[model samples]
Target chain A: MEAKLKYYLQIADNALILSHRLSEYCSKGPFLEEDLANTNVALDLIGLAESMYIEVARQENEGRTGDDIVYRRKETDFLNVILVEMPNDDFAHIMVRQFFTDVFHQQFFSELRNSKDEFLMGIAHKSIKEVLYHLKRSSEWMFRLGKGTVEAQEKAQVAINKYWKYTHEFFLENDTDSEMLKAGIGVDLSLIKKNWLAKVEEIFTMSNLTIPTNDFTIEGGKQGYHSENLGYILTEMQFLPSKYPDAIW
Target chain B: MNITALSKEELLVEFEAKINAEQKIEPLDWMPDEYRNHLIRQISQHAHSEIIGMQPEGNWITRAPSLRSKKILLAKIQDEAGHGLYLYSAAETLGVTREQYIQWLHEGKAKYSSVFNSPALNWADMGAIGWLVDGAAITNQVSLQKTSYGPYARAMVRICKEESFHQRQGYEIMWKMMEGTKDQQEMAQDALNRWWWPSLMMFGPHDSDSPRTGNAMRWKIKRETNDYLREKFINKTIPQAELIGLKIPDNNLVLLEDGTYKSGDINWDDFWKNVNGNGPCNEQRLAHHIKAHTEGAWVRESAFVSGFQK
Candidate 1:
């Protein structure tokens, strides 16, 4: 695939998969209003994904459509960082995961607003508008969970520990992203990652939560390797599209 | 001695002219203590209702039929929580803290809307909640926007603007299911039947039986009576039910001479029973809430420790 086409697909696939993960909280959130807010974020993510996929299809010349890109793609073809695809083991875990990803994506997309690529920049621009709210809401929860009580403090710390390993992969720059950044396609993930870490570290310190230092790190999400969670997510997400190849609903 | 006493009649020439003229009553404005208490009770209950209302619909997040549906539902639920927060803030303007209100709920002194106590059985229940429950709520909310309390009225105005989409999404679910297979249609109908009465009961007891109505109406807190909105709901919902190819659960639902659909007597006995904690899912619902509160204690503590830095 051409780099631009591949570039668009990476962004699109990440949003699509993560949105699927977020949407899982539809009826299962601790409260009704939180469910609604979370779901709105999910919709925004998916809508953003569709737009990116359309741009990707335009460049591919493979006769593929948005649906084809989203539903037809197998697990190895997906490119979302593993941080988003992780399970919502508990409400704290979910909030921490969302906080980590949203803060990172906010920086990434905010920089992409100035991209030389018109369509990619446009999508990123619109997406950052929606993402600001997610960042605000998720950041608030992280603060609350981290600072509220002893138990809440411990839970936040544990969530930070468990998910910290996956956070590194978000900034891992390969040829595709680096070349695009040079052409002003988007920001370099490595730079965005550095800023994301600094911001998150400040939050962690203030929240009275400790960041775990482990030499072991999970990689290869961008390179098509993912955790076991993505497979189940893919199974449920692809079921309808797989059954009816051209289904539009 | 039979009517007016001599001393009282001699002194009765002077009343507060502005209060008698129906001028806006500020918190510092002198009034009966009963009026303040009544406003507190009503507004606090309204605030509590918004908070607890999140349960039934929240139950369906894991099983939303589609990504679109899930997204819509989530947004709607978030609005409900925001509404609760807004109402709490409004109530605080009347001199109450949110912590006190939550404590009342924990101690079983505060009451939320009775409708939310029921379970959301399936995806269709999500449709029913949005369509009927939120439909009834909007009817009341639109009226409440004109309520006498300044802050409460403003909150209602904000809530009503965002509420328009909620009912439509719900009815859209029913529309899809009605056009879907037999099983789906039946699921929608079953949800409608089970939820119909509970939803109507949400407006509270009949006008004749409700003591708070006269005072609330006089104070402009409750813009309309229970019977009034219930009639409007029937008149509006009956046509909607026809469009969806479903029957209204009540058999005696018929158009009156004024073109209002007269519904049957609401079973207040069942209402009281449910209010007394014997509803089908009341225990289960509270249990879930308490568990979440307990389990998520650590997160709240951490948030405090973080000191709002993030």
Candidate 2:
């Protein structure tokens, strides 16, 4: 039971953090259409997190609300991988990070749809539709950036190099993941990784970009370890709610 | 179409007759130069306001208290962006390119609403801006739905419908805060106090003093005077504030037997100052947009190049 809850937290934490990152680009998109599209994805990711966290609150049965789970948790307890917390240094960096995650999620959610837990399966069923659209958008953006102009292609290359090292953490499983896999409650990250790489390679071929050869990887999200980024994200995200603990927004 | 072959005086007479008869004027209609320029200026400025207005509300999107709040604010800003697009498209019908309109905004030759020039200072400023700022803008826009120009009026109809929800969402925030702790109540009241005067400033100057109103009203481009709309906003909004237990922040305010709230004099000095490019956030708002525009140039260029290659 405890491993199942952590399984949900792992996914929720990633979506919630990434949603915040995308929301930062609300009015700052490269164009009006892109601005709307970026924020639309931000809204969808928050909805994804909302569903998962609501289930987390329900199963915990501690009289805790979804808001409490999101707002009251300390920095060290969040389980999102380091990649989603990466800064949106520019549009190139933003799209590369999104493409990496979307490719992974496209496989992860499709696998989760086969989970023994029906409610979790329902979430995956719903989320896979959104993930499909997300994958299409990010892949199109990757192709555009990789083939667009000389300078744009250079920026895209820099961004991919910066974020490629963190993608390995997506498949890093810990005790909770293993336990959930044994119970048939969560996804098999190894299978997700193979599919992620194939789709990525296919897109890169059309994008005229190269996959990074260096495979230096680090992993700590399962232990609630994070980079310096999550703290700043939590501080800004939790400001108003944290100020007045009794307040309801 | 045949109106173009008529003499200038005859065309003017026909245009006035159409406006007087409440008939729609199509894009091909032979309107005067002054009329065409007025619609271009008004529509583009409105579009610029929608674009720049995103800044004040957008700051709170990341900091929104919950998933629901975050989604609502995000969707609202996206609608503002959509509104900007619609207005720009409508203005383009008058033969101006969207690029030229954006250039005018960047060069400071175009002016948006003065209300956005002030900073959104607090969390409750979100509520205040939606309730007060959007509320006031809606009051003016509701009348604009019946404006004489076809495209501008139709655009107003769509924008006003979306705008109604924003004001209510804002009022909902204020009501929830008013029901919260003392600090929250203080925040809500503070937002109201700061935003109230600026919202009144949104309605523009009184009819007698407005130079633009002369031609704008005579042509039905402006359906109502500025003072009339300001009074309507004050009358409708004060009761909402009082209902939510917020003070109106106007010492000289009065309530008439006719159930209207007569506001004190607007701070026209500040209004004029902001109009003349000297507000607290006028430079910041425009610069934020210019920076985004500048940064986005490469993305646009790349899309154009790759688009042609395809």
Best by lDDT: 2
| B1-310: candidate 2 lDDT, tens digit per residue | 4634688998899999999999977788989999999999999999999999999999898899987888888899989999998999889999999899999999989889989998888789999999999999899999999899999999999999999999999999999999999989999999988898989989888887888998898899999999989888888888888898999899999888987877887778999999999999988999999999999999888877767544
CA lDDT, candidate 2, residue A218: 67
**TM-scores, each model vs. reference:** 0.81, 0.97
As for candidate 2, its clashing pairs are: none
Task: Give the CA lDDT, 0 to 100, for residue A51 in model 1.
Answer: 77
lDDT of 1 by residue, B132-243 (tens): 9989989888988877666778888999988778988889988887887676788789999999999899888889989889867766667799989887887888889889
What ranges in model 2 sit over 4 Å off? B1-4
Candidate 2 lDDT by residue in tens digits, A36-136: 88988888899989988888999999998888889889988898899999998999999999999999889999999999999889999999999999999
In candidate 2, chain A reaches a TM of 0.98
**Interface RMSD values for the candidates, listed in order?**
4.7, 0.9
The prediction achieving the highest DockQ against the true structure is 2
Docking class of 2: medium
Q: What is the per-candidate TM-score for chain B? A: 0.89, 0.98
Correct interface contacts retained, every candidate = 0.33, 0.73
